[model samples]
Target chain A: MVNSFDVARLAGVSQSTVSRALRGDSKVSERTRTLVADAAKTLGYVPNLAGRALSSGRTNRIGLLVTDLSNEFYHRLIGPVVDRVDEHQHEVVLLADNQSTSDIPNRIISLGLDGVILATTTTDSVIPYKLREKNIPFVYFNRIAPAVPADAAVIDLTDGMQDLVNAIKRNGYKRVGAILGPKNATTGTLRANIFFELLAQNEIFVPFDYRVNGDFSIPAGLEGFQELMSREVPPDVIFCANDVVAMGAINAAHVYDIKVPEDVALVGFDDLPEAKWPIFSLSTVGFDLEKLAAVAVDLLFERIENPEADFKTVELPSYYVTRKSLP
Target chain B: MVNSFDVARLAGVSQSTVSRALRGDSKVSERTRTLVADAAKTLGYVPNLAGRALSSGRTNRIGLLVTDLSNEFYHRLIGPVVDRVDEHQHEVVLLADNQSTSDIPNRIISLGLDGVILATTTTDSVIPYKLREKNIPFVYFNRIAPAVPADAAVIDLTDGMQDLVNAIKRNGYKRVGAILGPKNATTGTLRANIFFELLAQNEIFVPFDYRVNGDFSIPAGLEGFQELMSREVPPDVIFCANDVVAMGAINAAHVYDIKVPEDVALVGFDDLPEAKWPIFSLSTVGFDLEKLAAVAVDLLFERIENPEADFKTVELPSYYVTRKSLP
Candidate 1:
């Protein structure tokens, strides 16, 4: 419990001088800085972040707001983001939007974060507007809210979808079923629109009853697949919103004793690590997930450092990764 | 960015009065508190946590120190911990020990956290000693460092191990290969000792060459399985350290075209959500993960509130879950 005052007493300097010296403020002389540092290290005095933040208006803490921590996708995303943030000497404060409370913006504000990386914002979320009103710097990750302009790192699924459509056409799949994510999410809506448009252009039409939208969850995929299969005529090919959903669909297929690719082709987006597992071997739209995380952290830091800078959106390209799931 | 001064000016009170009223100090008049609250709401002022922390040495922040963020085990653990911490009106600060800097203890101290929950401490780690020297309160989650005694929530593998050993005896498996976790971790060492002791009691002896120790990871499992299978006489059954490693072994078996439970039986610990997946259907030891998280968080909060209380360790019991992985 050694405090700055203790270090100051041991170093024979004023408490303010000790603070400045320990902070490496150039105002303090080199000799004073060394003396203070030695004294602090001897006493094992760890400077409190709150006091430092009060003096410098920076907490060196960034908020990573994710919606679902249980999702496998976030499992990979959180690690890279934490590593990158650590490189900048900032800690990550995990914030989950799982609670039904609408005071998430206020919670973020109360934490006194330097900035936030919004990994779970929906297209219609009011959090962005509230944050804008409070002048809190934030950057969108994977999803964006049009109500407020901000920096974002998102994926362009056009090329990948095109390649997937080509595969569908070549495979001569007559009926196609889709299990999309929630409509409120930009990732879901945009991916669905692009997929449907591409499929139409390729003369592969999905009937209205063949499409289902749910949250990006395994249960949703499982139920969606069951519902689609019970239809009068099931689609030979099923497109899942993401790898998690695809895995769920595969699990459902296993329960029903349906063989993958041989009986029904399954394709997914976001080729997460599990997609490549020998058992899953899921065909998915792939992108550099680590790169996406790095870009998002970069954008958030940029927004924090240059608050008045022009809002920029960095869209990373995606590609199709063919595996055993697709015929 | 409305400061306390703005609220004080609008409320016709001193800045200190405004602060006291907002913090619900008993000395402040109810009428004055209402006036300050109204003014604060009107100005949209969010109290700076730094200022609050400086005044009342509590950050209301709890740190959850984890070794591997990419591990699916943590993915499930983090959500429940976050949820439990949130119920106490506190935020969770995620601290990963992935860096080789050896300054993790210092980093925790610098964050000014009220307490920490250690989820990944090796038995020989110096972190517990450092935290104890600093008088920082922490509770062990899943793993513990025996050097410094503290509150902990651990698992007891006796019942589960006994059941599993009974299953092994019933199946009449003569040769056994094992993929254990790191020798440095208490979990790995404890589980291995218990399993081996139980097997010895039942007159089942594993040859020295059939055991491979590794970190609790998929890659480790895969590599360990490969190494074991290459032996002149490969064992018929493989015991994985945990579910994640079990998955890697399963993947390796699939790649080598080895039929699980037919060519080789696999048994894993920590029956993770993926264990019951139709693709995996792994037989493993099961515990209430959510309850463990809650107990850890509760122990942390208890220690934070009463630092002088005698350290208590709550050991949750585990059970064996049967599936296709084990014959």
Candidate 2:
């Protein structure tokens, strides 16, 4: 029940000054802000989110819209996004886009999220348009919708793919296979484009049978790898869409008793924590996923606070991590 | 601007009936509820959570208070918990217990959460007390606080540990090393008690130097295993506090070039999804974590709707999973 009045009384400041201080308005001096904050802490005063939202038009709650909650790849982003949101004095509302449930736009409005970070927007997704119609600010993380442009943080896989192709060439693996992600997704298409272009430039061609499409999942990798291996002339190497798929491929290799880097080499993108485990040591295209997630949060907050800010697309650097999987 | 009145007009029902139908009151007949829901959907009406909270005293948001956000072990639980919550027309607000930030109880109140599910309560944690003081309904998940009794969903590790120890005896392995979890944790203490008691019954004892305490983290497992291995006569087998720690021990074993099941067998608890990866196949105790998380949410909702109901403790079944690590 503690309110700004109690904090102001305890801090010996005017009620308006206490409100401004608590709201992080620059008009309030640091000394007064600290004084009010300390008093608020002592009084155990927590500004009601609903009241604050009504008064300041900000809920301090950001939604992270993920399409696939079961995917472990999304799991890695939650911690980093939450950490950065917490740094900005905000909390995360994990919004899973389940088709069976109510639409995401309704959930966002119902929950009163200040902004949203779309981590799994397909190129043709209508979510961005819905968000724009509602005047809800959103930042795309690792994916983009050209139809409805917004702030985005995406990976530049050009350099990493080149390094991986070079490594493949050096190892003299001619028959190559690939488990590509869905062509509808920007992340999947971009990586596939870079991967195939690099390999084609090196006179390496993956047969149609060897080129399988997955949903960037573990089962996709397992099934794709198994399908490739079942062929009369199996591929000597498999390039997966991402680490989760690559892990599946590795597991499949184990099931078939195929030695990594000996029977068939595997390379993955994203280089999730599991790829780095000593047992796997999966060589993968690497980027700071934590940093990418954090930046997406930062961009979303910036857009929320400054709606007039120019739309930005931050392309982070990537490199190939040479590990036992390839060597 | 579309409100219950608009839905009521479209559905040819009274405004209060629309409200009751939207709030899922059983008093509203199924056909009327269906008509109201369809009308609301057609109008794209999102009931304002703040207004609804003041009127109905329900926020439809649940806080999942976790101590460690960076751990992958917690990541597996989030998806299932969110799915279950969404099934009941609720959303999850991920709340991390960071001391540098505002206290959890204050955050809970500020966020206007209907209930909370405490997933990481150490035995000495003050969170339970704070929640009780505020009369906030909560359910303990896989952990408990003796000072404050509440509804809980936890695994019964007694039978599983017995099976594990019996397998250990049958294998004729001795000079066992253990990485026990923090003694202050209910989960850690309970598991350790079962482990040691079973070993004692089998006339096997772990030397003081062989038994180490960890905080149930990856680094803790790595350090504990390394410490045990550094002894002049290292134990033939190592039991970790949990799956995360067990993975650490397995990684440490790989680092020392010790062949699993040949040089030192490894055992873990929890049997996380990663433990079943073909690359790992980690021997561990198994329980239905998804069910456990879902039941915690269920218990919290039960307490929220029927606060006078006697608190119930749901003990889930557990068993031992023997995989390549033990073989």
Candidate 3:
């Protein structure tokens, strides 16, 4: 097995120059880098990864921090993120957020991750602060902490919300019901606020009794729909916080023998794959989910490579997809 | 920061002994191990993971290699496997098996995984041989490579098949249509064999045109059901390879305006979470999926610790669940 020393000798460069060239460091002139690369290929030189990592202090492993693995929404993001991370020649280590926020810094240290993607950061989570204090590179994925200024990729729900509200008013839906996500979550809170404000503009109000809060789960959607349906006269339409909740509501409707679009129109956010099934036909807020996931990976890698670069937020746009459930 | 040397000095042992004891090496006596553990705990010494990895050639990172990330069945296993791996003080690295078999050995070598779980190995996959050649620890998860013998955790479909066949016979179903898994996969071949054998015992035959092979996916189920439905005299019942396929068939039924259990009854294997939805009420073969995933992780770690141990296969039992879809 030929080593980088052999390649360096053949290329007429120092071993340190060989290392920098192989790492694609810009400090190494492009011409020298090409010569080193050619020599390495000719010699069949496979760089010792462990030796390189120890020398450079880089793990080449990224951590994806997630709170809920059972959520289809979160798991769906893993595929695209993994694909993107693979392109960067890095492996992904799934880090479950089951431990306390204070334990996160220690966990990251123990795992030896080069960087992390906070996929499920709550607004109040102290993890961002801890990570910043430790100087561990990280980027918020689909969620943001107002107090801890950091890189993020989020969904812009403006156009989607406008389309949804217009459709609801046109459908002659007066009374409304809602199954909102937990108030602590930025995603849930922002979506609920936008939904209610749009409804208010159209002179539609959902009473307190007709609104319920869930933890963005199927069971939550089912129970929330059941609780609202027990009213003297249930609201005509229910806007779910997400597609998972909307699916639950639809399942509940089946159990109650309530006809969708005839008895109650159901709408959801995050047009997940399940939402497009002919059996569901769930009208939903749609965006390029794969692209969002890919962009999050990209932003995290960008931050990792250029730590001094100013933090920025990348907001992906969303639109409404009309389906049988809404019509 | 307390290093291993501090713990070794306090425990009255060599630093090498301290490291081996912390790794739970059989060479270290139980008393010595306990002393080292206690000393390390008292000093609050978090072992330097990267340093240990380099010295011991053990990264404590397990790889889960999957072929398709879009499949819900594969994603669902991540939670339980992650939980089990956490108990063993190892982190999981998600590796996609999208590249050719020739590229797998290099991919594994580059990732620097301590061990791997082959979650989606096809019968023809050469991954097991490559892993063996590399001397990397691995265990088959819910799949088997007959060409390469190894440890595996699989579901026993016997009891479930008996119950399903009995139900079909009792319901007076003569004509049957089926969606079987891929011919190259052990899971698909085994399931199809058992199903057809039992049906033959009762003198019920599924004609070739009424039978189709799928990759155990929703789209496969939809297309298979559609092909059978176009028959001049369609089969009264359709059995899907798995719940995902069953869901697709159910969705296609909705699209074609065909009533489930009235126009046609549908049954599936692998009672996934979506099968229990009131809207689907899919009757499926049920088993302890979490336990199977947990056992796979256990087997992998067991092999890692005792590489010389004889390879064994663990089979979890399954039963048929009766739901509205079957009736």
Q: Which number leads on DockQ?
A: 1
Per-residue lDDT of model 2, residues B263-314, tens digit only:
8899999989889887678999989988998899899999999988998999
CA RMSD, predictions in order: 3.8, 2.0, 3.0
Report fnat for all candidates as fractions from 0 to 1.
0.76, 0.62, 0.55
lDDT of 3 by residue, B1-327 (tens): 688999999999999999999877789999999999899879977676788889988898999988787887877888888888887878898887773322556678656788999987478887889889778889998878877788999988899999999989988887799988888878877887899998999999888888888887889988999988899999899989889889999999999999998889999988888889998999988789899989999999889888999998999998999999896
Q: Candidate 1: where is the Cα deviation over 4 Å?
A: A1-45, B1-47, B100-102
- TM-scores for all candidates: the values are 0.90, 0.96, 0.92
**Evaluation by DockQ, superior candidate among 1 and 3:** 1
Write one digit per residue (lDDT tens) for candidate 1, span B89-183. 78888888876543799889888899999998478777888888888899999876777899999998889999999999999998888999888
Q: Give the lDDT of residue B313 in candidate 2.
A: 95
Model 2 bad stretches (over 4 Å): B98-102
Please give fnat for model 1.
0.76
lDDT value, residue A1 of candidate 1: 63
Q: Distance from true position, residue A59, model 2, in Å?
A: 2.0
Model 1: lDDT of residue B167: 91
